[model samples]
Target: MESFNAGDVAEKIMAAIQKEYKELKTLNVMVLGKTGVGKSTLINNMFSEKLADTGIGKPVTDKIRKIEKPDFPLAIYDTPGLELGGQNVVNALLADVTEEIKKGISSGDIGKMIHCIWYCISTPSHRFEQTEVDFLKAFLNQTSLINVPVIVVLTQSYSKADARSLTAEIEKENLPIVKVVPVLAEDYEIDEEYVAKAFGLDTLSEIINNVIPEAVKKTFIAVQCANLEIKKRRAQAIVATAAITAAATGAIPIPFSDAALLVPEQITMIGSITAVFGIRLEKGTIYAILSATIGTAGTTILGRTVVSNLLKLIPVAGSVAGGIISGATAAALTAALGEAYITILARVVKGEMNVKDISTAKGKKEIARIFKDLLKIKRDNNGTAIESEIETSADNTNSFEIND
Candidate 1:
């Protein structure tokens, strides 16, 4: 009989993670701005990996460089400070940028294409200079044919009044840009008396999500760290789909010995969630989660191990048949597992927990507690079809909160 030992299950999940990640289409973005506009800070805070500081930046052209991390599915075409000393220099920079976009278009690969552009201005400047306006006019006219979306990012906007003033100024120009967004990418200390908290990057992230092609969104969500709600919505959708599939797989009662039947769906769900959160996971971490949540810390199979352990840890589940489990039972169990894992990953994303702790004794205990707790809430009785868990209803909001 086919069975998934904990080691085998862990290997399967890791393989699935690799497969899903590699399958993601690379997302390409172009950022243009003068120096001191806080572009690096904005980039680092908005994405999962610090693509600005940590990525390998090599000159794609004398004026533009491509920043990329190894095996990461994102390419940021970055420009050096745009002093805009002369019309000729601005024209040269525009030429280099457009040529690069043209190359991506010629390749006929969407991954090679430039999906979006950001033109950042320091809000403290308080005025959108005429030189910058002329450059934007020419740049907009040049890229109009290619249909690239450009967003004017007002960076270092610690003062709401200053940000709003600059925003109105830019809006008056009415270049065909996407929108004018003001962002305080990181907290700023004005003095002993005042500090400005980071804001508006989530709005920027959501705006980008709305504009980018559907093909690149999977990679976008996986790599973006600014918006937890985006990641949660995607993870919850994965859980709902996996739950429905698990229900179908167990529609007919299966003996406990055959519980391995539901293992594949659950493994895929776990892999996809990891990809979405874009968290680094070592094999031991995955093994720890499996051991703590599914069974005791030794050789384990999804079938008998889950039912027997839940019976031990949860008294309300006492009524389930010892030898066999129903479809409703399978769906609830799978949904609980998916939701539990989502909560763990969300905590890691928010810095409330660390991935390194997953292998620790305390971490393992907390994980088990979350899994059992979810199982208690997600228990289904009527074998009803599972719907998406992302409804605005308040009930779900409390259940998935990242605990301290």
Candidate 2:
């Protein structure tokens, strides 16, 4: 019999996950503002990438362009800042936007349709000029006809007073805007004397999250960089789902030799968590991590030695022992693996850990250690001895069969 290569299994699982991720629909957002209102900067900060620097975007229309990151499921529709004084320019821009949105809607690709709009105004300006307000009012009214939600974003607000005043003014106007969000998208230095801190980014993210439809929430959670809590929540949810799946798989009476069938779900769960954290792993790196994990300490969960030894015992005893490795064990093991990976990724994101080291031997050992500790914790909390559970379940099954 050939020994199972954990690396090969890992590769297959990652490939399945990547394929599924690629099939998800993209989330489309449109950003509107004057050129200097820091639209590009806001986008870069919020998404953790300088998208405009990539130069990968193509012109969607004369006045609009779409910026997309490779292998990412979010796209930004960027519009040139409206010329407040130029009625003709504003009209032309509006015409183009309306046409593009209608085109997307007509094609029945709602995913391609712009789900939300961010109208940015710099806070340092202190107040909106009359022309700017007029322009915004007109734009909001026009877009409302198309049933698109518009969020008024006050950007670069160095002081709370200014942001509050601006928001109040907009609210007083009773414009058709869906929400008014004040955000300091990036930290700013104003000389040796003072530096402005980044704030309200999470609020902006929450607003966006609430506005977008449910279908694209995962994409939003994955793409936006402002809210670590959102990513953590999504990761935890993935772990929970994976744990449940592992438990379900454990309920089946598969021999240890056929345990490869349990791998795909775990892989998919890990892939989903990584996607949420914006970590992309190469195939070779993934294989190395999987091999290292199994080689280091995964034997406890995978039960290779135990299975082999149990198989040498009497048939009924061996079967009963095998049955003891139940769904609870699978759930505990999977949850531990997921949480360990999440911790590692969080550290990487926070600059405390090096991403390049993740596939290294030392890194894999640390991960394996964390996994084992977490697994032990989970098992202890559950308070079920593997042998006792399996024996009880097996005996119950036998008794039911005898009675029948």
Candidate 3:
């Protein structure tokens, strides 16, 4: 009957978070585009940080530069000298690029290898040059055995009609590329009177998620901030797994006071979800979450008073008998906590909530409200929360250019 201490649990969760971050392998993406194709804009918005500006880069080769940040698990290999100047330029750049790819392949470490390649084309240019097409063709044939996924990205595609036309043209080439995604990474002022809203980044993020190596999918999920839905899906999966684990841990009807036994599973779940969101949670933030959702500092989560409070929110916990907790009750509690945490994080991602304010009273009250609402929801047979997903429609318009 050990007391569940919020302070101790917060420390453990913090350590778990560090461990999760440290374990994430580096996700390497090569971005190929001529200058002013909005490659910098694309890189800046695709990730959590302004990586193109802040990342320390050095020449990987004459034309290629590798950009990476300290302690960040992503690398962007950029081609600053790339342009369809002529066949000679394309062949020289191609030799440098293929050699670099071969070096990555020979490294024998998946993390060091290029997981994906992005060929960016500026939509305003309207026509893809023959040199560019020839380069891709030769590069694909040379690296055919390596199997890295190459995606053609049409940048500044504020005009959907132009994007569609460009897409059709790229598709006509019948290149063995993954997808030609048209993306407007950020809003563009079509004129003083109107601004084109950002679109297709979420679609680009989803496409990359579908193609990257399984080993680096978690890394991609952690690094990319273009799609909130991608992060939500991965975080929800972690919650589902943790909920089932909690159910297993409580199979023998543990005494209410010893429910701290569930802490380990929940901590892992929290750490993993934090990684997926790529948000660093301060100790105060963790304490605020536990205090609001689990219990206060006076009576930690498993205390008789706290358990009773939880039971009040969760009417299905009527099966608890003589201070014993059932597997279902444990799972429900776990799921509610996780879902509430995700809500808070999603708000932060959307910029609706500030991270520093999470420890404020208003934030705590909001967290408590979410947790209670989730607690009242029914669970499925597998102990996962029974909730309906809200779906939204987006045109995943992918455009490629074919330049003769």
Give the per-residue lDDT of model 2 (tens digit) for 158-253. 787889998898788899988888888878787888998989889888888888878788888877888888888889888888877777664544
Native-to-model Cα distance after best TM-score fit, residue 221 in candidate 1, in Å:
0.9
Minimum summed lDDT over a 10-residue window in model 2 is located at 395-404
Q: lDDT tens digits, residues 1-404, model 1?
A: 65547777788899999999999999999999997788888889888789899899999888898999998999998897577888889889989999998999899999999998999999988899989999999999877889988899999999999999999999998889899999999999999899999999999999998888899998999999899899988998998888788777764443344353336788899999999999879889999988777755655455554555564433234555646556666777777788889989998999978999888987887887777666656345422323433322223323321221
Better of 2 and 3 by TM-score: 3
- Candidate 3 weakest lDDT stretch, 10 residues: 395-404
Residue-level lDDT tens digits of model 3 in 222-281: 999999999999999999888888777765444344444346888999999999999988
TM-score of 3: 0.93
Q: Which regions in candidate 2 have their CA more than 4 angstroms from the true location?
A: 250-255, 292-294, 297-323, 379-404
TM-score leader: 3
TM-score of 2: 0.83
lDDT of each: 0.80, 0.69, 0.82
Off by over 4 Å in 3: 252-261, 387-404
The positional error of residue 184 in candidate 3, measured at the CA in angstroms, is 0.8
Instruction: Show how many residue pairs clash in every candidate, following the order shown.
Output: 0, 1, 1
